[model samples]
Target: MIIHFYNILYAFYENKDIINKVNIGGIIVKNYIIIFAIEAGLTIIYALFSGLNLLNFLNGTFTVSMIGLCIGLFMMMYSDGAYSIMGHSFRKFNYMMAPKRIKETMDEDPDFNKKLRIRQEKYIWTNPILFVSLGLVIISLIAMYSMV
Candidate 1:
């Protein structure tokens, strides 16, 4: 019975259309907060393992800002990479999994997939807002460090 339930769950995720829709819905929900938590945990572990006084580290404005900068950059990198790989993978999966009519139309117009692919690929590299925000954070971190 347990094996049967697992198979049913696996089958649902294995369906490309369902998975793509789910991924689309998750774009907003799946974001930097999750990465920040993971990075924070790692940062805490590093601080502890390195024999740093946690209170002193946390009390330093520069140290706190630098940690935030690191987490933000790491999240940006992760989000960009995932977007790049998943966008391409989604297109391929769509081509393979689309219904008969859609697949026929897609085949009739070779450029259809290509055009959609270019748009999706553009997001991975052309996020000005993310870059500007990260830049501001880094600048603030540097300013704080200089003041210290």
Candidate 2:
């Protein structure tokens, strides 16, 4: 009976299941959800094992959120090593994850700064990791609040 139930659940969550589909910024939700599950799952397991009675889980949730926030913030904080007038980018803290094309064009291309501006405008919209971190932070915060 248990084996039959297990198979049924597995079949329902099969790869072709449309109900499980979600598109976030051209990235699939399940891909990052799995990453989230691993992190959160381990936290929950640790909490349970340590007999903290959910307090540990709450701590883990906040920690995960902070981790995400830190990662996203740090990613946006520093500029890549490219053509910026010596201390300019360091002072301003412009986009850190400029594309190879943008980095390559920075020094050689006269219109690099203009292109960098445009690129920065469209920036962070395409970073899946940043999005994941943001999602983690939001979800974890919500979970933490509800738990409290």
Candidate 3:
């Protein structure tokens, strides 16, 4: 799994689009470390603020864990093509396309599911922010269990 992950990331970095977006400092701080710091600070501060007492603070750990887990989970879901398909909303609003292309009598992309799967695999490996959230989730879960 780790090897496959590395291969996917290697291919991603080799891409022209991602290569343009990456820099040494931006990759380290802006993309990865800074996000973790932000998530940690937000969760910890919220826990402290809402749970001033010891027992309440322990209770807040659950909230913290849930938040981290939810963020990580949602990212995974989105990468697997959640909002990519406007679906019912597109039909109702007809805004994803004008009335012309929307009414075209053509079948959907036959390879859409295959492309979606490939995209999801790439995203799971290439997205450092998702890993940061997963890390935060693990930390929060540990804290919650250890405190109890």
Candidate 4:
């Protein structure tokens, strides 16, 4: 059973697209690291405002964050290859997972302009989202300090 499981996972790991994405840090690593860093920073900031002295807060946050980070990373790694866990190659999984409607639409439409427009629309909200997150972080920090 263990050998079979290893073989299945190995197949997914060896897939060209999966290997390329994993190696280039495109599919998950970079984005997941940024997300985890933001969450960990917020956790530390919240801990700091919990009334513990700096040293205690630092120590507590470090301990808690390390454990939480390990667990979080493990879960992310496990989920990154959903198909591998179910005994399917990543390439096959991705092909199967793609939306049929989107594929058909793209196939029927040869215009590159529509695709470019969709891509641009996706990026339009990035600035607003970042600003909102920054505002929320600042407000939380101020509120936490006010409590002290």
Candidate 5:
């Protein structure tokens, strides 16, 4: 689950810049199809093992499935766009408010600062979504357990 969440976040963040540059709509459609396949597989497994009536389970799962599908789809389509826009806006605001560029001192040691900035940017892009997804997955597991 952790790995899957990371993959999702990575895919979102890495593609963010390219999203505006390329065919994001097509990418999002492909992502939805992949998710739909996974959901279908899960439905089949649940039907086979849970002794739940297929039609009844589908009825109950439909709404939750749609919610999950939409979340997944939107995350794929716009997560990066959302993050990049927010990040850019905040950086612009900070630049306007700052006394000077903090990198002036680091200019003499450009490589070190460049590496640190790269690491920081990667973490900043990934951490929030990871933590949020972790929370959601935990809640989902708890809910599933309660149902059982």
Candidate 6:
């Protein structure tokens, strides 16, 4: 079950079309909000169900939440860089695969080229959902750590 869940998460991260559809600027803003929500939700769950000192757990939760936030931030930054490269490669592949002059000409225009680059950049760099999911995973790991 855990492995399956992890695989699903990985699949989501690997999905290029979904990443491309999302706006990078929106992603950056959404990520912070989502991460905060995930942290709060996890903290609440741990407090209610886990066998731990409420106050101590709260402290640990906050600490873990910060760590998760940092990890999420790092992932977002890394993915942004990686996506830029990957998206560029994909766009090149698409250009190559395009049929004939009409298709080729559309991709050749300077304005179109510029827009494509910008869109690809945005797609590659931003993923609010992934960050939120990662935050939850991190929080879960922290809870387990505290238990141990």
- Return the top candidate by lDDT: 6
Candidate 2 per-residue C-alpha lDDT over 42-121 given as tens digits, one digit per residue, 9 for 90 to 100: 66776777677666676676666566657655555443323344445553344356676756666586644532331122
Better of 1 and 5 by TM-score: 5
lDDT of each: 0.51, 0.56, 0.55, 0.48, 0.48, 0.58
> Which stretches of model 4 miss by more than 4 angstroms?
1-33, 80-148
lDDT of 6 at 101: 88
How far out, in Å, is residue 82 in model 5? 2.4
Worst 10 residues of 3 by lDDT: 111-120
Per-residue lDDT for 49-145 in model 4, tens only? 7765654454444454455545554454454554344443443455467699866665576552221111112232233334334444455455547
Write one digit per residue (lDDT tens) for candidate 1, span 1-148: 6764564466576773432333322242133344344445655665676668744334342344455556556556665566556677888798888999988898898566543332222343223334334544465466647657
Per TM-score, the best of the predicted structures is 2
Q: Model 6 over residues 1-148: C-alpha lDDT tens digits?
A: 6765564467578783443343443343445565567667767776767656756565556655666656656666665576666676787777778788856686678654523333223343234444555555566566667777
- Please state every model's RMSD to the true fold in angstroms: 16.6, 10.7, 10.6, 17.3, 14.9, 16.6
Window of ten residues with lowest summed lDDT in model 5:
116-125
Assess the local accuracy of residue 11 in candidate 2 as a C-alpha lDDT between 0 and 100.
Answer: 52
On a 0 to 1 TM-score scale, where does candidate 3 land against the true structure?
Answer: 0.42
Higher TM-score: candidate 3 or 5?
A: 3
Sorted by TM-score (best first), the order is 2, 3, 5, 6, 1, 4
Of the two candidates 3 and 4, the one with more favorable TM-score, higher being better, is: 3
Q: Please give the distance, in angstroms, between residue 39's alpha carbon in candidate 1 and its true position after superposition.
A: 17
Ten consecutive residues with minimal summed lDDT in candidate 6? 116-125
Error of 3 at 133 (Å): 2.3
Q: Which candidate, 1 or 6, would have the higher lDDT against the true structure?
A: 6
**Clashing residue pairs in candidate 3 (N, C-alpha, C atoms within 3 angstroms):** none
Off by over 4 Å in 1: 1-67, 74-81, 108-111, 114-148
Estimate TM-scores for all models.
Answer: 0.30, 0.43, 0.42, 0.26, 0.37, 0.35
